[model samples]
Target: MNTRTLIASALALGFLAACSKPEPVVEAPRPVVVFTLASAQVAPAALYTGEVRARYESDLAFRIGGKIVERRVDVGAVVKPGQLLARLDPADAGLNAEAARAQLAAAENEFAYARAEVLRYRDLVAKNFVSRSVLDAKETAFRSATARVEQARAQASVAGRQAGYTSLLADQPGVITAVGAEVGQVVKDSAVVMKLARDGEREVLIAVPESRIGELKKAGRVEVRLWTQPDVALAGRVREIAPSADAATRTYAVRVSIVDPLPALQLGMTANVVLADAAASAGGLLVPITAVFEHGGASAVWVMQAEGELVKPVLRKVTVRQYREDGALISAGLTAGETIAAAGVNKIIAGQALRPVAPARPAAAPMAVRPGAAS
Candidate 1:
């Protein structure tokens, strides 16, 4: 092998290698579920079930304890002022009044006798037939008898008032909503015998859960609608909210005052209450839950950016306002109309080429096949 021959062989080998080129390396783009960012449609208000009630409902009870002898009113009965609703047994009250009157009469007779004796004693004292001490004793007896007469009169007045209480009279005009006592039933003093709902000013009562109590406090507008009259909506305001949650249901009781209630609204009617906030329902963007991934100890998503004819994944950090069952509410770091990888976000990397496929649809359920059907 001379120098010229070796150089000629190396040149021939290099020419052959240059003429036969190596196969080109082509990278296939990865398929990914894509999603577009857009403003989420939020509900204008939250709904709660409620019941219509009167603004003033009171329990009617007997002032004195006795067995009921008469019940003139029943549930749903309309009553007027001073109208008799019920009556207790008058035997006891009448007897007490009679006893008081008899005692008063006896006191008056004793007073008359004392007055006569005092006069006689005075005459005797003037004539020197009786001592001055005897006249003084007679005057004292007259004064004591007069005091007894006055005391008996007061007792008679109380007894008369008690007899009037035996008859239950309606203090106000209202409709009876409940009846707790009937004829022949014995009731104690102050025990509720009936329920009356005054015919004015209606309200809706609803229960709210503790989780959405903050939204209730910030409610901008409230609306109420009766179940029977769904088209007619009444303006309402939050009149009261329970300070604490209920022990059994663990919900707060809310009362809404209807501004101008219609005639159709009756007691115990079912209704619906809605709470709305215009400010809070705007400017939120939702993305698929799978699109969000943790990147560098922060929440991020793989945003798709067009690189000429190919789409590339770009890691972008975003501020997640809330994570919902359907998606994550993105408050920042993403603009409307932008596209992102909806699934397989963990496998995505910056500058990675992507195919940008539409989101995968949920799999259809298999059709039921009966025995001895098609093979």
Candidate 2:
């Protein structure tokens, strides 16, 4: 054990210790979340925003002009057929009717006196006591009296109708939606006094783009969801499609009749309509909108694939039929039960190996709030 030997050993030990400091642990790549294409028997749909409206709305008007003396109903008041809704002052009408009746009675008495005079004249003429000119004059007088009586009767009938016109009545059962006049307000002939929404049926009216109108008509049926009650879906049929497009919007009007009574649904409520076709049901796939990517004026998606000892992603082209808030409907270049990257899609490229990731669970549906109930 010499001093030289000890110094050499100590230097060698120090060199080994410096060179062999434990290597830092290498970390594995972070895992990505992806969704697998699923084969869901979804009823294909096309959604539209619309409004609930009554099937028939009637505007009630006065047949004759007069000051409104009374209004018997207000907005939201329920009325039945032939129910009195309002009335004008009948004073003038009553006076007119009385005048016509008095004139008619006087004309009847005159007619009776004329008939007796003609008979007396005829008997005198037969006895040669009266001249032929006098008999002729008596006959003419009787005919004129009869004509006056007929004219009086017609005047009486006109007066009766005018009196009846003072009272306004409902022609059908309905809810009063509006009152256009107030008490003491002078209204013109045929002026609208009230608005009524008729019973029996209700409908949803929507405006759809002209380009989509043809497809909608071909689809045939749609599902309606009220904005107030998103969870409750009601069935509707395509009742009408306007032939002309609106000048400003370039969209056509579509009316959908609600098949069943939705008591909770009311007039003026907003609605969402879903339109579907057979092609959508048979061969299309729906994916979250975020998963779709654009490239060279075409739509593409990042799909996860397997590679030896590594996980990567590849971009594949697809055809987008339509876009939805939560997802998109793909017409081509994708299949059910295949995995695709939903997030971090931009970082992926063609033919890259990728490890499959779990799809995100769908969000829970919100609870429905009934009308007049606390939200």
Candidate 3:
């Protein structure tokens, strides 16, 4: 059984071992993703939360103090100019007016009697039947009567104005936003009874930081979207900018006038004002927000490159013009139709071989269904 049999068996075992296929090194397939490179008109813009306000708001108040006898209008009621909104009890005012008229009539009668007496005295004085002193005294009496008549006339005018003050009328046509006085409530002079706002001409008032004021000025026209009506976007022009920054907020008050007549727009409604930059809009590049990561004051996006049939993600410097909800507007260093890793960008390094994975879709909230709607 010797050396020849052992050598033959070993040779056969070695040949079998060599002929048996070693465990095949199976390479995983690269993850393929379907993407459409969309060319969108991206605006480089800064967004701010603003409030819609009426162009004219009036604080209606009573000119005179009195107990409110009647309040015809309530808050949110539409009113026209000169419409009666409230009325104070006019009994006292009427009585004063009557007294003033009666006093004026009495003064006029007294003045007339004094004038007749003065005429009789003057005739007698000319006929030498009355002395010069008596004629002089008569003239002085007539003049006193005339003074009394003038005083009565002045009182009557004041009483007339007081009577008119009893009724509070709307000075302008507007919607009543607030009502401060109630029926039978006593109010002092200059106490605001109601707040009126004009029907149309709405504007968004925003407080922009002082640092961004210059940038905002350069971005002339703004697009305003109502918070309640997000789908509806209205155009607005920069109407005014405050001369000085607010002491408390350190921001400048910027007013944007709404150009369209939006009947649905109401005062105090919240709005989003987007200030567009001209220079940034001229450039064309869109990058994923996740890919554009910041580290140590530098911003970058991961660009995928094909390395030996495998895609490798590499970090590339991107000039971010503006930050948006979905992604950042890239001003430079990116071309259209280029693939970039949307997520897992932090772990990836430049020139490192990566198993190209499909970009993760952003999670969305479930939509609320109304009653009787099909699911």
Candidate 4:
């Protein structure tokens, strides 16, 4: 009686304890960061490598053709205005000048003789010793001789200037960036001997591809970051844009001037020209590029539905008119102010529950009130 009664009592106790135990509690919905889609004119930032350059650059050259006798300044030489950069062989220029001087001297002697003859003829005419036509011929001779002398004198002045042109001088204070001609090399008039970058406002030179040329033309907000000093970024504006694309690279040359000058930014420093996505100019709501994913050959975003205690993500197809490197603008399918999952969109699936958390920005559409938000 004891063994059977004890076994049955133990079984009954075990059954009652199991039945009294509460059912397994369901897990709370996963909390997720949900931001309301805002209509902000934002675009992805683009970056391009470039070089820091002077706003004003000029090519120094000889004004007259001659063999270079000496090149005083090399590349990277800082020069002041009127500084002699190079010298040319002045022998030919001097010879031409000398010949011009000799011609002027001979023309002057002829003019003096003609003047004497004109005076003698005038005296004879007044005394009625010569006919009027004869005196007129002498005056014509005098006028011709005087004109020849002036022509020869002008030639001599031009020849003197030609000799002076043999010496190449800097027209402005600048640093020499390039040397195109060397000593013993014969260069023609205006042949670039050196490249001068004037000391002034600094600029960044970048080549924008044809695809991005439109953005350059607008000259939207640009920032230049130096390679040596990545932390230092200078805001800049498009100072000049080439009218046509480069024949070799098929890229347009763009010059961006620094809004504020800094000592660190010098001529020919490697830099990065950052261009903002064309959204500010063209109004559109910006979304993270990663936020939008492609599925079934179509683009879509994950939208949340607010349940009493759970928020569920539902796949919504959106029309994307344009895209940026880091984000995209929703052309259609997403409504302003609706909460959308941005952080872990790939992990989410239809019917997956979540906890809706409001973002910093005000939501256009109210978010689902969390269970504890009622207070």
Candidate 5:
């Protein structure tokens, strides 16, 4: 009884132990798209909409306010220096000029009388016929009269200038782009009467976002093209950059001065500005668009690490400078020669061990054998 029982218990225990040990768990390596990090010549190109404008634009305004009596030219009229653009009533200015002339004449007569009085005072003092104090009094009177005459002369000069200011004349050769006043319109002093685009260097004005302003400033080259003529690419340089961003648009105004502008390049035409910068293209790591994913509201990607013969995926937080159709420009949080997951990011698991296998090649077609040629 003892031998049979022992033998049966031993066999049963062995069978149970074998069944409890689960078959070695085996998992197939998950396939993911991986990209090796490498330095690439990234030509950064940014497109901005711009308007062609005169480099030196002037807003012609009236120095003296008056009722606009007539306008000589319409918008877009070319004018030479000293050409009359418009005029005021002029009757008031003419009256002022005449009054100034009358004052001048009166001052001259007073000056002549002062000179005669001074001569008489000098002669009386020399002859001792009049007391010294009497001569001194006449001399003081003559000096006071002379000061008044000089003041009157200055007043007349200014009045004469104001009379001429009633006529709005072009200070330089230019094309009129705007007229702010019509006939019978009363304008304030220094108010803009006409907008003029001086004939000279042309420029393209663009609004650049705050994010790209730094890159724009550091750009090595700039190019411009008109919307009508795409092939007419012209070279340009940064002529002006706004010191501060616009409060409304939060963009900086940029002016690109054209070099050797063509005669056909006119003001008010739409232009395209392209900035080519080497700052982003010189030294940075670029990954595929799919490689980046959002983590904790920050940018991150799965980096592949070589673990002996196997590959392991580790999460890396990255600072993304810019994103384009091709990929994202990584400003920080990555190093050269790093491998990152290019696709299938959602299927990834933390600390997952993986085997890096090259993408499988297309299977070679089986060679067809001649019918019954060989066994």
Candidate 6:
């Protein structure tokens, strides 16, 4: 009786064990591509193309308006101070001068006659021949005539200046960079006839993109190289930076004054401006762009913390100074020798267990087959 009962119990226990669901299998930690923060060298220097220009450029124009009958100098012509660069037709100016002189002569004659009459009146009054009121009237007339004569003389001087303006003269030693008016062209007063670049300090004009403008401002050293002499680098500094971006290009215009510019650095020559940092390690740490994620409107990364052979992702906020094609510069909140998730950051949860893996190397580009080469 005991053997049969034991057999039945064993069968029932076997059936119960088979019917119950097996415990769920524990899953292994998933692999995550991670990047290690290394001591980053300064970002490659930014290069910009620009043109050489004079620090003090002037637009040459006539003080008065007239037809341009003579243009002695063309573009690229160098002139000295008071050198005749161009001229206008002097006939009209000459006629105006002559008319002003004639008016002055007439006014002087009138003033002389009035003075003589006043003197005669004074004498007559002294002799009791003329009344004192008559002498006073003559004196008043003489004063008015004198005033008219002075006014005429002033006008004549202005006319003389106008005549002198007919001949365009260089006020400073410079090279003509542009010519806006030609011979026989009627130009208005103060109209630009040419552009002169004075012989003095030279500068390079460059435009920088808005994104890198801050870097440019904080640049440590600037160097300029002319296209004509690429091998030689001229030291330069930030002379001026546009307060606002350009409307068309959305870039800032920067003027770099060349220090002790060589004679070879001429106007309008193409030049290259290089902006670089002084120290190599000033760039802080560099991390993959994909590794950074936004957390509470601030940049953050999933750092891979190791614990007993297992890596756990810990979210850490970081200060990103700049973003480049290669990576994001970590200026603060991180140090060298830190590991972070490189990609698929959104899929990771804070403190989640993960298997840290090195980033996959980029596939090598296929070599091009040469024509008539072996297959």
What are the C-alpha RMSDs, in order, of all predicted structures?
Answer: 16.7, 12.5, 12.9, 14.5, 16.1, 14.5
Across 105-190, the per-residue lDDT of candidate 2 in tens digits comes to: 99999999999999999999999998999999999999999999999999999998999999999999988989999999999979
lDDT of 5 by residue, 21-89 (tens): 678978977666677775433234556889999988999988898999989999989999999999998
Candidate lDDT (C-alpha), each: 0.81, 0.80, 0.77, 0.80, 0.80, 0.82
Q: Model 6: what TM-score?
A: 0.65
Q: Candidate 3's error at 306, in angstroms?
A: 20
Clashing pairs in 3: none
lDDT tens per residue, model 1, 20-100: 979999988888888776433334344688888878899999888899999998888989989999999988988899999
Inter-residue clash pairs, candidate 5? none
- Once fitted onto the true fold, the runs of candidate 5 whose alpha carbons sit more than 4 angstroms away are 1-44, 277-375
Model 5 local distance difference test score: 0.80
Error of 4 at 33 (Å): 30
Candidate 6 lDDT over residue span 1-375, tens digit each: 699999999999999999999999998988898777654332334468899999899999999999999989989998999999999999999999999999999999999999999989988999999789989999999999999999999999999999999998999998999999999899999999999999988989999888777877786558888888876888888888999989998889999999878876678999988776332124446567888889899999988899876799888999887775346767678776777788999999878788887767942111111123221
TM-score of each predicted structure versus truth: 0.63, 0.65, 0.66, 0.65, 0.65, 0.65
Candidate 3 RMSD computed on C-alpha atoms after optimal superposition onto the true structure: 12.9
> Which segments of candidate 6 are over 4 A away from where they belong?
1-43, 277-375
Candidate 4 vs candidate 6, lDDT winner: 6
Q: Which candidate is the best by TM-score?
A: 3
lDDT of model 2, residue 84 = 97
